[model samples]
Target chain A: MPSTTSTRPGGRSARVRAAVHHAVEELLSENPAEAVTLPLIAARAGVHPTTVYRRWGSLAELLSEVATSRFSGDIVVPDSGSLREDLERWAIDVSTDLSDPDTVALMRATLGSAAEGGCACVGDRHAQLDAMLERERSRGGKAPGVQTAADALLSPLYYRALFTTEPMEPGWVRGLVRNLLR
Target chain B: MPSTTSTRPGGRSARVRAAVHHAVEELLSENPAEAVTLPLIAARAGVHPTTVYRRWGSLAELLSEVATSRFSGDIVVPDSGSLREDLERWAIDVSTDLSDPDTVALMRATLGSAAEGGCACVGDRHAQLDAMLERERSRGGKAPGVQTAADALLSPLYYRALFTTEPMEPGWVRGLVRNLLR
Candidate 1:
């Protein structure tokens, strides 16, 4: 069988992976969900279709590589001793990050794409969110009230972003935190 | 200039209206968003595109007609005195209705179709949700413990339905109500 690898041997593999990542990002930037096709991604990344398929298995997986690259950076969890304050800080940061137009659009696209069929990317996204929540809980110290606190802190931001045209303002985040904690 | 009035002093006007309404229901049943083009709708209804435009003015209005025709029968909100029970009933109904594979697929398609570009249907859907919330609040009464009982009551059901493949079971709805009430 002919070798289907896009990378020839050793040194070229890293370069090919980087190229594919960049191409996926560029496609998402242009058209969120509409631009994610395997052939187009392969052409842009200068790899054969077989190579792309061999590497990621599916277009959703390829897109997952691009989407998650930006999210793995350090997420600081403040420990101000007060659970309310800690949650407030976390909500502010999360609301600000999630309220970005591009981010919201990308999320909507991801949801839409997943609704069409199966995508491991959706599972990865959920895992990432769960990890972030877990980290925050650990930092602040979980109480009996932690799960409800977490839901109250996060659900509104997501609901607002999905249903309303208005960007989630800092004021809303602060209000949500205060109300939930109180 | 031809009048855009739906009710005309003619023989075929009433028949045409009925046919259009039936066609809208049939099409939406099959594929909510895909089945809503003016030409296709008119063809299915055995009417003219001009007639559809004359009556509804836009695709969103046409969709609204279909949705209202199908699901607007009656949503009885019982005043059980206990917010948890009332919410449980409401959540079960909403989740059960939305969890229908056809309904879920249709909603996804409608949402995705709206995300693709400017679709008045988006605004219409939001308005409908808001209206439903308002009606429930007035009918069911509210609890003092939660910030907004409505949010706590409804958000999880929606979030779970949108993200997970698990069927919305009665136990899940009961658990959600219990958790929110806590």
Candidate 2:
């Protein structure tokens, strides 16, 4: 399983990957996870259905690739010198991302995949959370364990984002950071 | 709309509703929400598809009805009088519910509806959460607002339930309660 796409930037194969990725985003914007199919994605991307099938064996694999590539640069740990400020900024950043319609669609898609398809790519999200928390701990933040810290700092944003109609305001993010720090 | 079913105990219409409800649970156990349709439910319940359609306008409405009726009686706020104990019990109860395969399936389904279908019945779950929190507050427990309390108390269970492979253990529930209370 060597790279199907070229290592060089802007190559023909790379263009295919990019097209497929954009097609996924477009489909997810309008439909939930269960509604997205390989044929539709291929048609939207203007790629051959056989190419999509060969390149991505299943919908879960394609979604995982798209989610990882799209969100990998979304979160960056802040070094504000104070744990409170760093946590607040990080929480707000994540909140903003979650609040975006496209991002919310992605969240729904990934969570749906995890729940129904048992997709292992869900670990990517937890890994991102762990890396963010680990950075804070390295900078002398006195937070709980990585898992617990994730529950404290990140769960609320996701909770509201998914379950409730309540707004995820900036002040609430500040409160979350203060509570987690305390 | 007047009552489609009589209030009398074990009436004909009551039996019909019960059969339909059980059919929904059974179908959801084997399939995702989108896969469960009115005809399938009617056939499984030994009723007519038109009956289900007339009784419940859409799948989201029907699922919401089933979820609300089923879970309304599941959580009873304990009078242990201590907010810490009460919160821990509630969290564990929710953890156990999330661990149950049927409940998790239902959660995924309803969340799917909320995320994709713009289902309004998602408010039913928040109402249950608020009622539980108000009970604790009425008992002299000094906690955060109901929405925030739901975030602190229940969000982590859902986060792990929907997002990651993490086990929502009893110990973690205790820890969540302790942190939220502190």
Number of the top candidate by lDDT? 2
User: Would you give the TM-score of chain B in model 2?
Assistant: 0.82
Candidate 2, residue A25: how far the Cα is off, in Å:
1.9
lDDT of 1 at A53: 93
| Each model's iRMS | 4.8, 4.1
Q: What does TM-score give for chain A of every model? A: 0.69, 0.82
Q: TM-score per model for chain B alone?
A: 0.64, 0.82
Per-residue lDDT over B69-101 for candidate 2, one digit per residue giving the tens place of the 0 to 100 score: 776666665657666776777778778877777
A1-182: candidate 1 lDDT, tens digit per residue: 14545446544677878888777666656763543678888899999989889988875466555556644443466666666566677668767776666555555545544434332222333443445446657776554344455346555665556555656677767876666655
The alpha-carbon lDDT assigned to residue A61 of candidate 2 equals: 72
> Which parts of model 1 have CA positions greater than 4 angstroms off?
A1-18, A32-61, A64-82, A115-150, A178-182, B1-85, B116-150, B171-182
Instruction: Please provide, for model 1 over B37-156, each residue's C-alpha lDDT reduced to its tens digit, 9 standing for 90 to 100.
Output: 778889999988998899888665665555454455434554565555666776687777767665555444444333333222223333334444455567774433333443454555
Q: Score the docking of each candidate (DockQ).
A: 0.24, 0.39
Residue-by-residue lDDT tens digits, candidate 2, A62-174? 87778777766657767767666767787888888877778767766654443353433233445655665677678776555667767876788877776666678999889
